[model samples]
Target chain A: MLELLVSGFAAIFTDPLAISMVFLGVMVGIIFGALPGLTTVAGLSMFLPVTYVMVSHVGLSMLTAIYIGGTSGGLISAILLNMPGTPASIATTFDGAPMAKKGEAGKALGIAVFASLVGTLVGVGVMIFASPVLARLTLKFGPWEYFTVTFFALTLIASLTGKSVIKGLLSALFGMMFATIGLSPVDGTPRYTFGSLQLTSGFHLLVVLVGLYAIREVLLTASSKQEPIKVLKYKMKGLGFGLHDMAGNWINLIRSSLVGLGIGILPGIGGSTSNIIAYSVAKNSSKHPEKYGTGIPDGIIASEASNNGSIGGAMIPLLTLGIPGDGATAILLGGFMLHGMQPGPLLFQQNGDVVYSIFAAMVLGIIFMAVLMWSGMRMFVQVLKVPNHILIPLIVVLCSIGAYALGNRVFDMWGLLLFGFVGLMMAKFKIPAPPFILGFILEYQLELNLRRGLEYSNGNFWDVFTRPISGTFLALTILSMVVTIINNHKASVRELKEKKEGTA
Target chain B: MNSDTKREVQIGIFFLVLATAYIIGTFGISTFTPFGNRGLDSRSIPQLIGLLVIILSIAHIAQVLLREKQVKALLENEQEADTLVCDEDEVACIQPVKGTIIERLDRVFSIKLLLSFVYLTLYIAAYQPVGFIISSTGFLIAESLLLVKKEERKRWRTFIILFSIGASVLIYFIFTRYLTLFLPSGILG
Candidate 1:
């Protein structure tokens, strides 16, 4: 493993184009992440197809670089604009905005950037060690195990990541239905292709992604009126602050990073939820909890670190189990498929060199992300001033280029618009998009494994429950749905009582 | 009911209709049972998913109806019921439009959103015939003019025009020349 990893670093260092591509990815990612509407997922979705013409290792490395930079870049707007650039940085604004108001904007940026660096390193470190062990554990898994795991993941995403579990499940089913449009998996039977050759191949994951995240985001920004942001001025001199600033903060940093890692390793939740969870956990553990939202470095550290940490946390599942933890990794799984590789237990044996190179690129990308945020802080702040009017059309053009590049067909571009409308409707209806995305990505595998499991069982559906691993996952799925229902009922009843008391 | 609840009910009905259509569509899928009749085929999962969605959608509608009734019952029995006034602005905004459903479609799809969609559709429609450079340049100009403030557009007009032309050409060269990707030249080639 160590030898392969070293060779991976050697491959990156040997290829100048790969190194520069990583740099470009990080720069592009930071720009996307710093802008309030464009997110890390959008960055990956738009760029994933652009990498189709590159070598697998170089392309994969570049995608991961974008992931690291985008996850860390949200602090820029959280501090300056008070609007979090991405959901991952929602908790950053709690202290970041206040700190900016108190004229410690530089101090806040400095601490956030540093914490991001540490968090990413922690996540990357664990991923380097953890993926192989997890992959090995999953090596013994069969069709039944795979089916149960995917089922469990779908239920987890549906229940955990949204306001309403039914809505989440419906969004997921909608995605699955869309996935079934093209050729049916394993059997080569066409399901719902209404005589169009383009429909025969179904919607490319890239088309669905670019449509849902990037194009929908553009339309969303266009429909809503944009308010002019008051740009805040700040300075960073010699790493902004020092080791003295980080004094007594080692435990908070470690604990938050671990919290981020834990959430990242989970199937449905990702960095967006982890940062907030880590911040709350930090607040609960802090001696002066009330000072949390009132211009403190503690809040900033917890947020930036955990979100960055989840970057690595997300990779662990993506690499080991071939199950993406979030939208970004789901696109990455698409990237891997585009490159003629699937990330699973067999990936290490087949593509050890590519996997190791991705790890190496992440380590290097984190360093580059921190350096870019500090040295290029002045430039990124200017990015907030770019009006959405020009920005929106430009993004549409760029994303259109991506959709077109999918099969060098104009059909995918139209598909982008169709899904974009669907995405917009999903948002308006309060149906969560992440579960929809994950469900779409996993639908084929779920069906494939289910059929395979049935074939293996010789028509015995009860065999799934008889196996220890599959049965446990099935039981947990039932437990989560039941719990969600009970909690939802209690919540509505409580709301009713509150309403009654308010009227009385 | 408040607009928020109304929206939830609308969402519930949307899913119910979708499930019914999906289940009907599942019947059209040609099943291949190479592993014998007992083994699940192409239509099985879709059929199962369609049924599940139908049940869930019904459950969602029932829950919403039951909750609305509970709240209504509580509100009617309250001595201070007059204090629980609805948000007038929201109620006025969501009130059914005074027209046929087809005419009311405009209420849901805003002009800006509709224009943007049309612009995108036109741009992609021209992508094969007019080429990426020409179509994209036109899209950027039209879309930017629509998005930019009317007053600001007059000042930024020249800049937007130049950027549109420059960006499309630049993107064309970069992808075709360096990335070795095939982009249609259409008549321009």
Candidate 2:
């Protein structure tokens, strides 16, 4: 293990191409992520084909850099513009936009950059040391166990529902039904293809992502308030933090990073939730909680730290169990497969070098982003000056091109349009698209596992309940639903009390 | 337009219609058995989803109706208080009536429907004859120009067009030549 680790570090330093690739990856990723509607997943997917053409190790390293950089680069727009560049940076805007309003945009940007660097380093450290243990533990999982784990992850939809459980469940059910549109996994029979060759292959996940997020966002923005909101031009200032500042916030940074890491390790929850949870924790524990959303550096720090830390946390499950922690990592999993590498326990034994290179590349990527964001803060902020109307249309065109470019299929373009319309309706109706997306992603695996479990038990329905792991997972799913209901009831009661007090 | 009221009514109607449609669709497809799987069929998942949707929709309609009643009562109380106020206070109280949910829904849906139609028309028109590059480039420039607000049109027209054209060209070259990904060759082929 020591030898592999040393060789990994040595190879990264000695191979000039690896270092250059990491740098280039970070640059490209930052460009994609700093642009609104372009997420880390899109960035990775767009670049996936290129990885197939390159050497496996080099490709993995470059892709890892892109993943890390893109995830961190979203903070740029979230801090500068009120619009979040990626969903992961949504929490950043809560305080970041306020800071910009208060003429402390430069200070906020500096703190975010610093925090991202520290958070990424901590996450990478955990990944390097803790991945093996996680892998060993997960290796014991059977089909029933996998099914239950997926069930638990899907229960996250309840937490995300936010005052509309019925609507949320309907949306999720719609997603699950959409997933059943392709060929059946067990019987090898065409399901909902409607006799079209295109439907037989199933909907491309990238097309779904672009349609749901980018296309939907563009369409929604078209009728939005036309009056441009004026943002103050705050001059770029110093890097702002000294060694003492770092030392003072070390505890907070570590705590937030861990929170981010834990969230990342979970299958469904990703950087978006991590940032929010970390920000809340940091604010709640602070001596001045009232200053949280009022342009405080701690808010930016907590958000950026946790969001970037999620990159490392997400990669753990992808590398070890072939289960993606989030959408971005799922795209990365596709890249891994493109490189002829299947992620799981066998991957560690067979391709340890490539894995270590990826780890090293992650660390280097954070370093690259830190240097670039620190030095190029002004350039990134200039991105905010681009009007939304112009920006949104360009994104629409790019999405069209991306869809067509994927397989040179006109049907894919049709798929993109169809999904975009679905996404628009969903947004208008206040249905959460994320759970639908998650359901679509997991649909294939869910069907495959169900079939395998059934085949093992000769169609005995009780087999799923008999397995300890599966049983535990089912219990947890039930527990999550019950908790969500109780919480909703409490919230309703609180609202009623507040109304009564207002009336009195 | 009171959006809350319109939303409640429209959503109730939408759920009822969707539930009926899903049930019919599932039943229509459930009969075809391409494979002999006695346990579960392709229709099973869709049927399950349809059932869930029906249940949830009924629940949502009930909730919406209950909430609407509460809101109506609250508004009645407020109106009673307003009627007791002096003329000057009544003038202050009588601000512009808020837009209804239907109006907001119309605003959001109209734009989305328009864009979807534009893209759909573009796709159909250019799928074969115009090819990917020419159609995509033209769409990009035209859409950018259209999306620009009227006041900024003069200031942004030149930059937006130039940037869109440049970006389209760059993407065309990158995907076609470097990445070796083939694009639709409509009429340009």
Candidate 3:
């Protein structure tokens, strides 16, 4: 393992082109991450096809770098503008904006960047060791286990859906229904093509991702009142604060990192929610919970740490089971498939060097994210000075080009507009996008495994209960759904009681 | 009666129509049965999805209606204590006045938003004919100018134009040269 790790490091450094690509990918990712409404998924999807021309290691390395940089980039806008550049950074805004307002923007940024680096390292450590063991264990999984796991992952859509369970179900169902458009898994029958030759390919996940996220954001900007952001100025003295501040929060850092890693490894949830959950955990566990969301470094650290840590956590399932934990990793799954490299136990066994190289790239990417963000702090803050009018137009044009470049078809661009409208309407009606994306990604796997499992069992659906792993996962799915519903009911009742008491 | 409830009803109705269309469309999908039909067919999952969608839409509409009724009752109770009194001959004074068409149009479609949609639509329509570079540059400059408040448009014009051209060329070269993905050339090529 050490030798492979060393060789992976050598491969990236020895090749100047690979190193440069990593740097470029990180820069582009930061730009995407720093921009509101442009997420890690959008960045990954836009760049997925571009990596098709490069070698497997180089291409995958660049994509990983982008993911790392994009995940970390959201801090810039979150701290400066109170607008989360990415959904993963939403928790950052709770304290980050307050910190900036208090003229501690530099301190907040410093803590966020440092915590992000530490969280990423911890996650990478956990991923490097845990993935191999988990993959080996999962190798024993049969069709029944696979189906059950997928079913369990689908239940996680509830966790991602914020407030409305029904809306979440609808979104997931919509995604699943859309995924069935092209061809049936078992019978190879063309379904819902509507006689168009282009429909046979169905919609590219890139098209859906970019349309729902990037394009819809553009339309939203155009539709809304344009307001220039107010930028804050701050003076820093060497990473904004002393080492003493970080030393005091070591426990918080460690705890949040672990939270991020655990959440990230679970399919269907990733950095997007990890930061919020981590921040809540930190607040609940803190000596002074009231100090949170009031320009505190602890909140910043927890938010930044877990989100960045989840990056590493997300890679584990992708590399081990070929199951993406979220939208971004789903695109990473596409990146692997595009390179003709299937990511699973077989890939790890046959291509140990490349797998290790990806691990090395992630470590290097984290370092680059830290160093670049620290040094470029001044320049990144200037990004906030750029008016939305100028920024939105540029993003829209790039998004248009990116959509068209996929399959080199005008139809994809049209699909971008269609999904853009769909996404806008979904947002207007408070329907979440994450569930829809998860549903789309898991639909093929769910149907294929279900049919295959039943076929193997000679059409006996009751056999799922006989397999321990399958039964455990199925039970867990039911348990999770029940718990979520009960919790929501309890919270609603509490809210009502409070309101009544206030009125009285 | 509230805008939020109106929006919810509209969304629910839209989904209802969409679900109906999806279910009807699934009838065209034929299962390859010559090899022996086994397991779930292609149409089954979609039909199930359609049914679920219909059920959910109806439930959401009902929820919205119930909420709207409660809100209306509360609003009526609030207004009862502050009811306005007028003479019997004051019909014009008592009646609620509606805004002019121009005022309503301005509220619904502001100049900035309307122009934004127009430029974007034109850009998309011109993309295949006039080519990517030209259409994109034009869209960028116009949208940028339109986005800014009128007083600042004059100052932003040069910067917006220069930046738009530079960005358009840079993007075109990056995608075409480095990535080897061809943007539509059209009249320009």
Q: What's the distance in Å from true for residue B67, model 1?
A: 1.0
lDDT of 1 at A459: 74
Q: What's the residue-level lDDT of A124 in candidate 1?
A: 94
- How far does residue B87 in candidate 2 sit from its true spot (Å)? 35
Which window of ten consecutive residues has the lowest lDDT sum in model 3 chain B? B86-95
Better of 1 and 2 by lDDT: 1
In model 1, pairs of residues that clash are none
lDDT of 3 at B145: 84
CA lDDT of each prediction against the hidden true structure:
0.86, 0.72, 0.80
Between candidates 1 and 3, the one scoring higher on TM-score is 1
**Candidate 2 per-residue C-alpha lDDT over A373-457 given as tens digits, one digit per residue, 9 for 90 to 100:** 8887777666656676666665666567666666667777787788878887666556677677767766666766765676567
Order the candidate numbers by DockQ, best to worst.
1, 3, 2
Candidate with maximal DockQ = 1
**Model 2's CAPRI class?**
acceptable
* Model 1 alpha-carbon miss at residue A436, Å: 1.1
**Candidate 2 error regions (>4 Å):** A1-21, A32-64, A77-87, A90-105, A222-238, A318-323, A333-356, A387-390, B5-38, B67-113, B159-162
- State TM-scores per candidate: 0.95, 0.85, 0.90
